[model samples]
Target: MTKEKFKSLMQEAGIKSKKELAELMGLHYGTINNWGNTQGYPTYLNNYFHFIIKAKKYDEALKKGFDESEKPQECPSNVEALSLENARLREECEKYEALKRALKEALR
Candidate 1:
């Protein structure tokens, strides 16, 4: 991956600087900095950064209640299925809480 692309991915993942990326990835700051002056970032880093970006998106979506309409259409089938299941589980939890509340009110 080109240095520019790596930086872009880091930014997309909410990483502000090479130091932050290095800390998150558990690498030395110099190692991350060397990528620009060396041959280039390792090819695997491309996948890693992409994964980080996806995870960030998923985390944000989860925080927003994992609404089905908010799910990305471009996600792989497995990811899509997981998102659906998460939505289903959230619904179940809501139902359970409502039932618990009703039962408590009845007992009272």
Candidate 2:
């Protein structure tokens, strides 16, 4: 693969830098540095493009969890939930009061 494509794959697979990638692969930093200078990767990393795609898919899945999407859905916490319930109840109480007043007026 081209050097840029190789670097892009590394990033897409979550290795943000050459040093980090080396740490992940248990290799010396100079090895990766040399590969960059030569504009090529070792066969191992060169063969890794497909694995990068898989890694990206796995990473996305892990981040999504059971929600099954790239971004997390915002769920209300207990306090927010109680606040929403309180507002709903207050609206219902107002409706009940309005109905009671209308009934009294009709009985008059």
Leading candidate by TM-score: 1
Instruction: Residues 1-108, candidate 1: write the lDDT tens digits.
Output: 766787788888889988998899899999988997965778788889889989998898787764556665545677889999999999999999999999999999
Candidate 1: the clashing residue pairs are none
Instruction: List TM-scores for all candidates, in order.
Output: 0.58, 0.50
- Pairs of colliding residues, candidate 2: none
The TM-score measured for candidate 1 stands at 0.58
lDDT for model 2, please.
0.77
- Assess candidate 1 and give its lDDT: 0.85
Ten-residue region with minimum lDDT total, candidate 2: 68-77
- What is candidate 2's lDDT per residue for 1-108, written digit by digit as tens? 668887788766777788987787788988878885765667777666568779789877776664625434443355588899999999999999999999999999
Lowest lDDT 10-residue stretch of candidate 1: 66-75
